[model samples]
Target chain A: MATRTQAAPTTWPHLGLGARRALWAYAFLLVPLAFFLAIRLAPAASSLYISLHEWNIISPEKPFVGLRNFQTLLADPRFARAALNTVRYVAVGIPAQIVLGLLLAMALRRVTRLRGLFRALYFMPFVTPVVAAAWVWQWMYSEQFGPLNSILVALGLPTLQFLRSPGQALYAITAMIVWQYLGFQIVIFLAGLEAIPRVYYEAAEVDGASGWQLFRHVTIPLLNPTLVFSIVYSTIIYLQLFTQVLNMTFQDQGGPLASTLTLVLYVYQLGFQRFRMGEAAAATAVLFAVILAITLLQMKILSKPVEY
Target chain B: MKHVLALLAAVGLLLGLASVGATQQQVTITYWQYFFESKVRLIDQLIPQFQAQNPGIRVVHENFPYDTYNQKVASAVPAGQGPDVINLFYGWVPLYVDSGYLQPLPTDAFPVQELEREFVPMLRNSRFDGKYWALPTAVRSLAMFYNDDLLARAGVARAPVTWDEFLVAAEKTTVRDAAGRIQVEGFGIAPGGQDHHLIREVLFRQWGAAPYSPDGRRVTYATPQGAEALRWYTDLITRHKVGAIDFFPGANGYRNAFMAGRAAMIFDGSFAIGAIRGGTRAKWGVAPLPRRSAGGEASNFGSYWVHGLTVRATGPKRDAAIRFLKFLVSPEVQRVWLERVGELPASRSLVSDARLANDAVFGPFIQGLAYSRATFFVDETAQRQVLMDAVNEVVVNNKSPMQALQEAAAKEQKILDDFWTKRAKKQ
Candidate 1:
């Protein structure tokens, strides 16, 4: 029997039952690994190659230009404005969404009646299709006949130039985006709150800590992981912002002097509108670097484990 | 057993031969157009008729949303997967030609003399390297569309034909509320509409500066004449009090406002007539675009979407593509397109037809074809944007018209410089 087993081991490595199971596990993992490499990594690698050349998507000739495309992007004023707007999205939008979402989540935790219904209602906008939501927001922000302006008129107050004004368009769009994504942040915060051991809160109460102190000490610390995930996830979404700006701005897109233009929208304008595929690819590579850097910095600062 | 085996083998061979014969004779070709309700409807209706006429050929119809249509074509043609024939805006002819996306029409089949004489001269814009690349079934020209009751209320008897007269009409026809907010605009200010053409082709040229040289390399619109032309346009929004830029603000906002009787006058195109006709219960009239002076050179802007054969059509697919192209441009199809799509006929003969030419709503647009010039845009999207930004600089940012025009000229010149330099390199 020992000789036969030795022969089997030589013929097929991992002949034992545990080793066979391990081999099966590796086989199953290869499917997703192959999919990820093909679907995500291959195009990314190809895009990097294309960025070094003057790629005309239609024409056969894609002349190698090395760093010239990047040089053009760095000098481009439109690209500068788009990058600043992208930063504004992350700076203004993420904090507003997270704070509002956390407050709502905490408030809902105390409500006993129809708790599930409230959660479902709040979560609906997150699940709603973005195009439909964007158009709805556009109609709501219309300078002339939108309901918000109508309300202002009925109250004998001045109407605001919401989406049309250069000064207000960016913030107005950000507010709508915050509203759409708030429910997601709330769901995550609730799960984080639930995972906190109950004894910490009870022990704080027994030690004569006030309600505010209990929240600051017990609740806030435990929710750090959730907060970090939400911040990083929301930042990624805002960096690649395109659909809302495209739909809400409509024909003269990203305007009132391109107040709402984002880096992704600029990439689209370059690649599709101008057919400067090389420059667009260069812009995309910059965006990828910015995302990676910001996310890494966030993890470094926020990844402390709450041992308690 | 031998006889049965031979019989089975013979049956199999005969069926295989029949299939091969069928496959050899029959071929399918594809045509693509952006989704406009009327164009899509007519094309969908015409496919069966075309197939019936040529039983051995099949034409497939594909339509994409208007906004993403160009991008779709850009990606599809390069990947060798899109339509054999594509309907493109005439302004895009230069871009397509530069990219080698189009295959020029054969001179033997589509003679230059016949095309020059038969079609409106705008098809001349479709020529590149001295060869015609595309043809149109219908054409469109900018015209002033007015709400009759609103104009009458202002005591204006007919549509204003001169710039000063039109401004006077606009000021008088405008209605405001107690708070001085406009309830009705005299002239709808939508740069997204034909107003861009109004400034670029008609007013600028009529004022004194042709926007570009005939060869289209030089940017000639930065002169004093250009500043004056831009001043007149911006003055309508800022100083005139006849209309505001953001009063109604989408692609069709001004049109919708006019159709809803909220605007008295709008510089729109013949293509807008169908939407205005279908959307409103009010009385409306179409007039030729206003001139700088009462007898100024009757300048107007004309444009059309043309059917072009793509490089994708080759080998057996080329003949089918050409046949379908002919079907699309036939006299019968043009007449039906005029009725259904509200664009004027591209054929000189059909547009000059006594009955159709004399029709009140179409007469102004038809007359415009005589003097209308289709701008040879090297980059239509970028050029339009720079113009829009210039206007916004005046109305929104409070910049001077001359300064704005000067800046716009520099940007436009950069685009031209980049294009020509690259084209020279490629050659």
Candidate 2:
């Protein structure tokens, strides 16, 4: 039978018309691939190239100074502070948003009355304009006239400089970010929660499991994918903290002592304010690398197949 | 087979037709500005007037809110999408100049020397690099606007001419409740704010110094005069207790408090003249800012000048733009700018015209313009940010005046070094 097959000539090599059809199918994908290359990849690649040069955007002449812009950025104390602030924002904000999101989701799952209305109310901030929300936070944090100060004074508590204190500004900004974005994660968690089968909880109840026992044994294990989703999404968003801090801080002081200055704001200020486009581009590349690494790690750690 | 041939024929026709429709049309010149309510009216009014003046050319006017104008302009200029003429402040000149985004206004082209000769010297702060980069359309300066009814009630006859007399008036004007809580402050100056520009300018001149060196090249505020200016401002809140941060609740809260008659005296710029008059029910009068010390010189503070137009070097419609620019700066538009918008006209001739001089609110604003000085530093950003930062440190953080000034000077020096080093290397 093997000899007969060999003599008949491999059917795969004889399939010319099928191979030609496959080539046409591959050619169709080239449109989207070309678009991705043109819009996204081209700019990123150009930014990487430009980062190695010393360029004033309007100058008639440009000369390459390999990695000098990066060197300058590294040497600058402000950049280091900005990096630390960004790390702190991500480290503190991501976990808080996820946990809070999950808890709210669970609570919402159990509620039967006005669930739709409550869901919409909770999700409002997620859909609100970040700039407008930031401005609202600024009003709330207003030292003298804000509602927060009024409440504090009424309670006989010392009025805190929420955005004015360098020490407190970063955390205050992070809290605002978390407050604004938590609703989004909550909605995501809700969708994940809805996907879980009711039979698992029933089975746990039949097994004579307590409330905590059921959650610990069955819920936790089953919600692994949801937890992974929240983690990965929140990590990406938290690392790019900018809008709230930029709007809240006075133009002169990026932070009280440059505390709330994030990587994205720094890139914008350097490129636009300082006219250091090359340095800004390099910082952007670094930001991209950071996001890529975290995303890869998430996939590796959370991609295990589950046994139901 | 017939359907396939027809489809191919239609596709071929569409492709063939698409190749023929590519040609550049009439050039559209973009004008970017930050327009107030009144300014918007004038801008709208001028479009037809401008079009009538230059028939062939089309001007696309873009307006933005006052707050984000600077950032928007800065970002747009480098991308080749910036307006042919941008309404900008004098402080933005250095940044645009450094980046080579601005085309210099030659003396011969715009007759800047003639405009300079006609415009007030104080308003000439917009000119830079020994050439005009911007035309001053409207000038703003610090002036003392008081509630006449409140002043009369407080038993003060007129605006104080000297610092000591001002304090005395403030003391007489302020009122407190039974609990010793301040019910009415003598003056409403927002404390805990960075850079009280109007107040600082008056003090700097009183001490016989300016914010920066005359050349806009170094830190001149570190001198004794600048330190004296710093102290005088600090004393207004800490010592005199006339104006306090605690009194002004938040940003612009002091101004609102003043309007509400909680404060007897308020020092601000011309921009507030219209708002103060309209926003409040109280009878008000305007006066020049109080002098520093008896016989000591005083400077007008808080000159917030707007940007005028400049024709781009490579622009095709240079002649059309120049004619349009001239008309925009003419006395007719200046009158519209003054009467309609309440902006102080940049032209000396139009300002001296009887119409503006007769207005009660603008009279002092115009008078104060003669003494006005632009805040200048080697790095424009340093001049703006460092000063504001220092004020915040002193007023909000309660740092000593000398310490704040010293810290600001150090920051300014570092910025100056960065700017000069780059320039030197280029040379």
Candidate 3:
């Protein structure tokens, strides 16, 4: 029968099912692969090429300037300030968001009553438009007319200049960003919390483990993956912050002496506002490198091997 | 069946021919402007009238939010597609011209001598590199907007006529609560908005030093006169305590504060008139900006938007755009723009029109136009940011005025130098 089958039709080459399956999977992936190559990779590569030239958006000619754009960026004090502000945003914003998110997640995990309602309420800001949230925050941060200052005045406390004060503008914007992203982090943390087997907790409880000890030895290690993901995710978000700063300081984008300028905002100001596309591309390239380095560093330090 | 099929084919051919004929006759040209309610309404009205006059040409008017307008134009133009006609801020003309995004009006169609005679002297700003790049249907100049009710409450008789009087009036009009918090601001220090214009044009000119060199290649604001301008402006917030940098944080802060009766006076352009009329119940008056002294050099900020054809426009589209522009700048249309949009007419002939000159609110703005000067900006927005930063450094960060002005001047000069250097290399 085997000889007859072999002799009957040998139209196809003998290949493993796995090989055939991979070929079919790649065939299916071709559309998305081509899409990424066209939209994402092409622009990224062109941005690198554009960084080495002096080309205004409307200019027909793009003169090659070598590393002059980068040199100009290095000399620009505004760029330096923007870089520092971006670092401050990630340094201050990420931890505050992660801690608050984790604390909220921990509290909600124990609450059986109104838990879904609470979860939805916490997740609301994540879904809210960033521009609307920024406008609301801008009103709240107003020194004279805002509700926060009104309350402060009502309580006979000195009103703080929130967005107006250069010293305070960055922090105020960071607070709003954290508040907006808190809901998202909380949802992620809850997912991680739920995935922890209840048997482990019950087993620990039977062994008379205290809450602190149980959290330290059992829950913490298991939640490592979630923690790593949140840190890297929040880090990237804060690193490239644009909308909040843009909306809050709409008149003079990234202002009150540019205390709130982020790397991305600087790039935007350069490319669109200043009509310096080459310098803007250089700034973007710097941002890309920064994000790559930080993400790799995060994976190296935070991600641990998980064993069942 | 063959006859029926033949008839059907004949009808299809005729319909296709008709469509092609119709399309060939209609030349649609897009016109874009930054969103302003009054301007939008004016354009909405004008488009129908324009189309009625020119049946073969169809005008498509589009408005974008002001913040994104420049970026939209820049992106759209480079792709060899954008509005055939565009309304650009006067300060942005230089940048657009340098980038070759704008096409100068043909000399025969828009002769320089005719433009000089018809339009305000400030229209010379549109003439760059010996060409008329754009034309304004209407122009705006800074004027003092006062809340009459607040002025009465403060016991001030009228808007201040001099900077010294302005200060005293501001101090008297200012109200403070028991805890020393400002209950009402006397004046809105719009550092983030028009304060740059105020310092550069009004104050600097009054101090007898032009803000920039005649060639527009160097910033002259580092001079003693410019230093004094910066000092006086910051002192309103710091020493006088009548105004604060945060009084109105956003773009329309001064206008909003004045309209809300929170501020007794504000230095804003004629553009604020419509918003003031619509927004506030407070009695208001418009006056020319107060001078450094009662008889000091009279100067006001001449900032306006001009309509021009983009470089991408060609053939029938170019002809259509120019025709539309001529229609827009026609006396009748200019009058419509002035009456509806609250901006002064750009036409020199209309400036002497009794109806506009006799109007109480527009009179001051029109009178101020004679002394107005439009700044030559490489990148007006960026240059303004430098000025605003200097203001912030002084008022918000407590930096010395001289120090801030010096730094700003250096930065601004660098921008000018860079622009000129690039231009030279391109040449």
Candidate 4:
């Protein structure tokens, strides 16, 4: 009786159609907005709050330590190395993903036969379960009797310590990640390529433009939005790099002198392994800040106003 | 009106009886442990037996991958959920106790004196705050495992009894290529495995130093004697060149190499008895770890996994949890675990089993228990990692032994400080 005493604002007799529609839209939108706030924003805020305190999950007492955890992180060499490694993952991994993805997409655009098969072959790794892929990669990278080592032996080349060598472990992981993510990048690029009308290409050719000139002028500028999105997305992924390094590395704590350690893996070790949830939360807060700042910076720098 | 009131009271009494009947009929509880294939299989076999014995209580076993097991419990418990009973490495007891993740075993059912009398001395490592937080079915200590054929080929009739003889045997057993690349490592130097334990418990004590203070709160393994012990440990790799850290190059690489007969000898726990027996074709034997000098005191790192009743089990479930723990630690189950999982019986009575003490494969592990010392850890996994990092610094980066040892000491001391500090806050 109370709910039906008066209808909601959307059902008012004097309201205009647009106003009524907007009110109803908002009423429906609140469902998802509340869900987003609960599932995403709430936990993130709570995580930030937890970062300020000495929060061990199993313990009931969570006394606030007031940035002491962060202070510890600042002095932690593992934290420093992990942060640097995260940046390296982004700096080295993202560019390879972008360039290789673009090349593969372009080549696929040119192919006239077995197009579906080629696309499927390229995309399979992305769809394959990461844990499964990591184990396979671990075997392939084995120093003794791995398939890669066998190839090296057959070619009379020196065996490389792919995961065992501290200097090379990060790069080895980056290569695997690049291979796995290339399909996603390529698919996005292919769609961008398709959206570009053929008339622009013909228009360039008639003006005595070479193929490279046409690509440089026509394709590059038009693909600006797609490039910006990919760069921002890939940057986020590489910054939060974890599974490949964790699953591929020995003993699963980013060993080989922690060369392949990522910020997320460090956070995991802190919270779960060491039972220092406060430190882990502080580490995550730093990660969140880096991710947010880098993403905003990328979008701002890369987003150009394209004109036809 | 009086007759109607009487009928209502009878109905109420019947409903109360029905509810009591339901509560008494059955209570289901969950048990959790990390997945190791043999342990998981053994637990699976035992759960039914436990359920059958305790007809009113049903047991549900849940296993997670060893890597993420702790994380699963930590996250689940914060949300007011998880297992009624849990299994943990003995080293995790302090952390679990400090976090209040586990409840003290009911003293009425498990008297403190009786527990002390029945379980082996090493089981006392898990005790905190004047109460036993967990109990183990089996416990184990480190022993030297040698490839008999490799020793025979090197014309060494027996495993070395002293550090000097150990080096000579290692040199003779090592197989090298024309280019001096090691084909078969004389010693499987596994920092990931029990070698860290050997250095911490065996070497430090043998050379007249202790890894930690009496209370296990401070790091004290930074003395000249400590350096001598550690140098000798790392020297097997860098100075002696009998082995390299990356020879096999993966998780449990050293153990895998030993099982494949690519490495002549390795320090392992009795837990590897079943795995080694199954995985290797080589004729191998177990011997006591080498001492600093002949006829010196024997020292071993004793460790075990324990099952505990958790705080999550409340009221009626507490009894079921305790009952389940008792069945898990029973002598019959411990004996079967010895055969199946290769962990030694934690029972004091089984320590003198004639057949076990005289057996070739199990004798050394049993004897080592007489002097075994469990490293009471504030954080088991991290403390292990600190030693690994120390070893890696010396072996991988070519740092000095003393430098690595000092850095490791500082790091471990910090972990202890942070843990105790937080614990003090709670108290």
DockQ score of each predicted structure, in the order shown: 0.31, 0.10, 0.38, 0.28
lDDT of 1 by residue, B31-122 (tens): 99999998999999988989888777899899999878876887787777899889998877767777888999978879999999999877
Model 4 TM-score, all chains together: 0.84
Q: What residue runs in model 3 are displaced by over 4 Å at the alpha carbon?
A: A1-21, A147-158, A198-210, A306-308, B1-86, B309-324
Q: Over the stretch A1-308, how does candidate 1's per-residue lDDT look in tens digits?
A: 68867786786875786787788999999999999999999999988888999966666557899999999999888899999999998899999999999899999898799999999989999999988998888878765557887788889999887887888999999998998998888899999999988999999999999999988988888888888899899999999999888888876788878889999999998888877889999999999999999999999898888775
- The best candidate by TM-score is 3
Clashes of 2: 1
Please name the candidate that would achieve the greatest DockQ relative to the true structure: 3
Output the better candidate (1/4) by TM-score. Answer: 1
**Stronger candidate by lDDT (2 vs 4):** 4
Q: TM-score, each model?
A: 0.88, 0.77, 0.88, 0.84
Q: Which structure is stronger by DockQ: 3 or 4?
A: 3
lDDT of 4 by residue, A1-308 (tens): 45633564445767755787798899999999999999999988988988999866656668888989999999999999999999899989998999999999999999999999999999999999987888788778876546887777778778787886788889988999999999989999999999999999988888889988887899889999999999998888888877888888756368878889999999988887777888899999999998899888888889977887
Kindly report, for each predicted structure in the order presented, the TM-score of its chain A compared with the true chain A. Answer: 0.94, 0.89, 0.94, 0.94
Q: How accurate locally is residue A62 in candidate 4, as Cα lDDT from 0 to 100?
A: 81
Sliding window of 10 residues with minimal summed lDDT for model 4 chain B: B174-183
lDDT of 2 by residue, B246-338 (tens): 354344666778788888888776777777887878888887777766666757753444444443525565555565566767778877787
Against the native chain B, each candidate's TM-score is: 0.89, 0.84, 0.88, 0.89
lDDT measured at residue A59 in model 4 versus the true structure, 0 to 100: 67
How would you encode candidate 3's per-residue C-alpha lDDT over B275-359 as one tens digit per residue?
Answer: 8889988888988899877877798878788999887679998988999999988999988877677788888888887787777
Who is ahead in DockQ, 2 or 4? 4
Task: Give the C-alpha miss distance for residue A141 in model 1, angstroms.
Answer: 3.6
